[model samples]
Target: MSWLVTGGAGYIGAHVARAFIEQGIDTVVVDDLSTGRKAFVHPEARFVQATILDGERLVEAMRQFDVTGVVHLAGFKYAGVSVERPLLTYQQNVTGTVSLLGAMEGAGVHHMVFSSSAAVYGTPDVDLVTEDTPKHPESPYGESKLIGEWLIADQGRAHGLAHTSLRYFNVVGSGTPDIHDVSPHNLFPLVFDALLGGRTPRINGDDYPTPDGTCVRDYIHVADLADAHVVAARRLEAGDRLEPVYNLGSGDGVSVGEIMSAIADGTGIAFTPEIAPRRAGDPARIVASGELAARDLDWRMRHGLGDMVASAWAARKAAAPAAE
Candidate 1:
């Protein structure tokens, strides 16, 4: 059965799409190219250039591709910027999800894997987040993602839809030199860009309560995360029941200080990171347990921080000329 992959040209989406291809899964991609690059789409997969907001076109693509399942990843993903552009965020995230569900219904495609975010647990009190963590989203971005999950659940109950939302935290690194995280707000790209541009990357704070006195976060390799997606999709195709949500996380986490060290070692760029004041509401640590995911979806940290930084650096450096 062919699967429809929304946002397949985006950073994470591209990796997921490629992983599906490597697994011999037939795939079709739909992306508007708002934040995705056309080059990221695999040559084996069919591409549809359109936004999810365009419901009719989305349905047409779903039907034309003979899609039996879907992986929904298209949306506005910047949490910080959602504050300044709440309307656009909802339009692209909430409304767009609804439109996608409608398209799926129209095409009779029932199974889906939603690309959710950790922002849905904004500033959680627990050191380790779980699937059952109380969602107290602080930003429009988080709210929209939670809303998307709710929409999926409701649709599941009413229309017999099979779906699972995968909540991701601090997705970093590259699976290949051809693909890399390009978001300005992502940690890896921010540091890599600064170093590539001949500037020292700065850390916001170093006085946290953690062991290293810096923020600790779960950073899973993109390839690992993509593999989990393929597993979930296969489970759905096999009619296996799955959880409503799963977190693609690392049980043990790395600190920003540790990551900086990795970067230094990986790139051979030696310099102390400039420490700036912590941005308001920034927490000292936020890691998650991947026990459930590991049990069901074969989740694991296949690559270490050094691998993450080095692969990302290689891709980012390779793309520098085009970026300039």
Candidate 2:
């Protein structure tokens, strides 16, 4: 009846953990604090500080918690950074997932929900990527996530293990006061910081083929993403016979320029961005078709871009005083 959430102290993972705790589910968290914060861990859940690569430690935690299912969220997620450090990305994301799967099998935990990414789809020729989209990952990070999904699918076919892999895009917004995002790589937080510091946020490549000439992406609220995980878990727990993949996103795309405008309007931070060349390996437009998730999991994003920006700005403002 209990679940093990890897990287449960991280931004999205912490939100998932909080949602489970609020529903009175017994949970266990395993994180090494590499990028996650101890402050994000819920007090009700048993917390274990360890990496997924440590098979012995992961097995021990699963055994101790009597974990019936797992929500796998541990991985390196930065596309540009992954290109610079391919080996490390593979080691942490790919190899770490392998170790975690091995540990799960050893502990007899058969059901899982994997935190995959739209990065796995890369830049598809089509505007909206479906579940059967061609996966031509551009960076090591994307390839690593694709490998993780393949692992889950293969394990499910070979063994009796059941899983749901939710591929998400541009996850934003806040779920709780104690679990706000601290990563410096993502767009929303970076823009928030630039405005807070009285500096113009840099926009890379504002001359793309899109309507506004800037890259567009689907920005789904983190809470809504967490809700999909809950639905996926429940379906598996209920023994629903289904395929293993679902895209979790808003079915709508927002341009980078649009996001900057939203931040300005929401936070009253008026600052133009400095134009820069396109980031290497960035797709011009990457949106999701969550039709499968909507049909099967009854999942829909309740919050729009405005809501996402406003809530993110709220969290940023609350944390700004301490950061000063």
Candidate 3:
């Protein structure tokens, strides 16, 4: 039996796909290549060029790969852009997931690992968000991800669909030299680009209520995140029960100021980031406890902030031409 990884050409999806392949799991990748680079897909994995919205193609590819489960990672991921283009966001994340689930049902692929997001807990009031935290997603992107989780839950109730949704926070760093985060809205990429081009990177707000007067958020390494997904998939395959949701988060949290320092240290640059006015809807702190995931899914923050910055810089430097 093989696993179908949607959006396998994207950075995070590519890492998850590579992790699956390295672990000796049969893997097949289906990506639309809309925002994903074709070169990012793991060469070891079988690839199909198709969107999750294409039910016919999804079913055919699943069958062709003899897929037994799915790792749903394809979505319109930008929370900020989702506000401007809510329709497109819903279509990609919400409707796209619905279509993928339908195709999975058609193929009798009951097990799925939905790539949910921390966005589902928008501006959480609690210092440390747990899995039980009430979801109050702010943007259309976050709402769509929550809806995707609901869809998976509804399917599980309707049938014996063994599934789990892994809620990710600020995913950073690279698992391998060949793959790197390329999202324009991602913090690391944006900072790296600015620094590489001889521009000062700006922090949205440095006057928040946190210790460092900047936003505090969970940042997990891509390799560690990918490992969690692999273990989660294997546990499901082995009939091991898991919580419906898990937070792949850093319990202690790292402030934006700390991240800036890490970037400077990692890049051998000495410059304080420019502090711009606070972005709308910005929160002071939003760390999450990975205790539950650590217990069950082998989730842990193995890489330090310095490690994340260094590895990300290494990968970005490796792809200097495209990056510059």
Candidate 4:
């Protein structure tokens, strides 16, 4: 039996798919290519071009591939943009999850590892958020994710579906040079694009209450994040009990100012970031404690900030034009 990784062609999903393959687990990837790239999908994993919205197609894929579980990551993921596209976000994330669950039930595939987000804890008041943090999602994307978790939990209760949802913040870095994050809204890519285009990198709202007057967030390397998904999937497959949700955080905080410095150092660029006005709904700080994840899913920060930046920069540069 194989694992089906939805959105396996995207940055983080691709990494998860790669991790499963590396661990000698057969993997089948289903992606719509809306935001995911075909080239990012691992060569060893089976690829199916489809969206999670297509329940019938998903069922067919599970049966054909002999899928036993799913790593659900496909969705419209931009939190800020979700404000302008609530319907699209809900349709892709919430409704798509329903479709996937139905498909899983139909195909007799039970286990699921959902790629939830820290956005579910939007602007948490606590310094170090735990799994019990009160969810006050501020965006449609976050709402959809939280709702997806609820649906999954309900499904688990009703159908005995073994499942776990991983909630996380900024996912950075590249595990391999060929596979890198390409989200236009993500920090690493935005900074890399600025540097490559001979423009100054911009930071939003450097006048926060942080040590450096910038927002502080828990940034976990994408590789480490991907590994957690594999671990959770394996645990479920082995019939091990798991929490309904786990925060895959670094148990630390890194300010955006620090990230800018790291990027500058890693890229060998000497320039101060342009401080733009703080975007609306930007939280001053949001760090999480990955204690639960660490105990159960083998989650840990295997890469440091330097490694994260260096790897991301290298991958971004590799994807750049030859002249760059």
Top-lDDT candidate index: 4
Q: Model 4: clashing residue pairs?
A: none
The per-candidate count of clashes, in order, stands at: 0, 0, 0, 0
Worst 10 residues of 4 by lDDT: 315-324
lDDT of 1 by residue, 137-192 (tens): 98999999999999999999999999999998988888888887889899988988
Model 4 score (lDDT): 0.94
**Which scores higher on TM-score, 1 or 2?**
1
Write the residue-wise lDDT of candidate 4 on 40-89 in tens digits: 99999999999999999999999999999999999999998999999999
Each candidate: what lDDT? 0.92, 0.88, 0.92, 0.94
RMSD of each: 0.8, 1.4, 0.8, 1.2
Residue pairs that clash (backbone atoms under 3 angstroms), model 3: none
User: lDDT by residue for model 3 over 1-324, one digit each (tens)?
Assistant: 899999999999999999999999999999999988889888889999998889999999988889999999999999999999999999999899999999999998989999999999998889899999999999999999999999999999998899999998999999888888898998999999998889999999888898989999889999999999999999998999999999998988999899999999999978889989999888899999999999999888888888899899899999989766
Q: What clash count does candidate 2 reach?
A: 0
Tens digits of per-residue lDDT for model 2 on 1-43?
A: 6998999999999999988888777999999999988888999
Estimate the lDDT of model 2: 0.88
